[model samples]
Target: MYEASDLKKGIKIELEGEPYIITDFEFSKPGKGQAIYRVRMKNLLTGYSIDKSYRSNDKFQPANVSNLKLQYSYFDGTNYVFMDPETFENYSVNADLMEDKKDYLMENMEVDGTLYNEMVIDVTLPSFVEMKVMRSDPGVKGDTATNATKPATMETGLEIKVPLFVNEGDVIRIDTRTGEYLARVSTK
Candidate 1:
C-alpha cells in the first residue's frame, strides 16, 4: 500500500481494480486547500491514459510487476512469439503490446518484458539496434553544405530519416525509442 503523498513517476498502482503505471505526477498544495496530487497514468494493458487527482492521505495498493529477459522467436501474423531463456517457456503477445518496438525486433535478440499476474504488459527493446539500409536515394555532391537528412528504409521495413550520405546496403545504428538514425555502421 502507498499513500498519495508518496506517489512518484513510474510508480505502478491499482485504481478501480485496474493496474496503471504512473507516467507523470505533480505534487501541489493550493494556497487555501490541503495538499493534493495531480497524476497522469497509462493503463498497462490497454495503453489508455488519464489524469486524476488524489488527496494527500488517500491510500492505494501498489502494483508489483515482474520483468523477464526473453528472446524473439517468431511472429504468427496476429501475435508475436517470445521464448524465455531460463525456463524455455513461450509467451505470445499481441502486436499492440509491442507497438512501435516491433520494427526493432530481431531473431534471437534479447528483450525485456514486464509481467503482471503472469501476463505480459510491456516489452522493452535495446536503446540502439543495428539494421541494414534497404532503400535510399543517392546523395548530391557537396551536400555537406547543410545538415539535411533524407528518408531511408531499413531491413526491418521501418523508414527513418538519415543524413544524405546514407546509401542502400549500409548497416546503421538506430535508436529504437525515437526511430531515428544514430550513425552509419559501415560504408561497405
Candidate 2:
C-alpha cells in the first residue's frame, strides 16, 4: 500500500483492477487545506497515459508486476511465445504489445519480460546485438567525408545506416535502442 505522499515517478500502482506506472508527479499544499498530489500515469497493458489528483489521506495498492528473464521461442500468427528457461513455462504476449520490438527478436534470444497480474505485458531486447548485413551498395572510392554512412539491410529485415566500408555478408554490432550500426564483428 502507498499513501499520497509516497507518489513518485516510476512507481507502479493498481487502480480499478489495472496496473499503471507513474510517469509524472507533483505535490502541492494549499494555504488552508491539506496537500494534493497530482500524477500522470501510463497503463502497463495498453500503453495509455492519464492524469489524476489525490488528497493527502488517499492510499493505493502496489501493482503486481514482475520482470523475468525469458527465452524467445516463436511467434505464431497471433501471439509471440516465450519460455522460462528453468521452469519451461510458456507465456504468450499479444502482437499489439510487441510493436516494432519484434524486429529485434531472434530465436532462442534472451529478453526481459514484464508480467503484471501473472500476464505478460511487455518485452525488452538487449542493448546490443550482432547481425549480418544482407545487402549494401558499393561505396564510392574517394568519398571519405567525415561521418559518412551508407544504407545497409540486415538479415532481420531491419534497414540501418552503416559506414561506407561495410559490405554485404558482414557481421556487425548494432545498438538495439537506436537501431544504429556500432561496429563490424567479422567478414564472411
Model 1 per-residue lDDT tens digits across residues 82-144: 999999998898888776788888899899989887777788998889989999998877777
Cα-based TM-score, every candidate: 0.80, 0.92
As a whole number from 0 to 100, the lDDT of residue 8 in candidate 1 is 92
Off by over 4 Å in 2: none
What lDDT would each prediction earn against the true structure? 0.88, 0.92
lDDT of model number 2: 0.92
Candidate number of the best TM-score: 2
Cα lDDT tens digits, model 2, 1-188, are 99989989999999999999999999988898788899999998788999999998899999999899999999998999999998999999898887778887889999999999889988899999999999999888899797899999988788999999999999999999998889999998
- Residue 139, candidate 1: how far off, in angstroms? 2.1
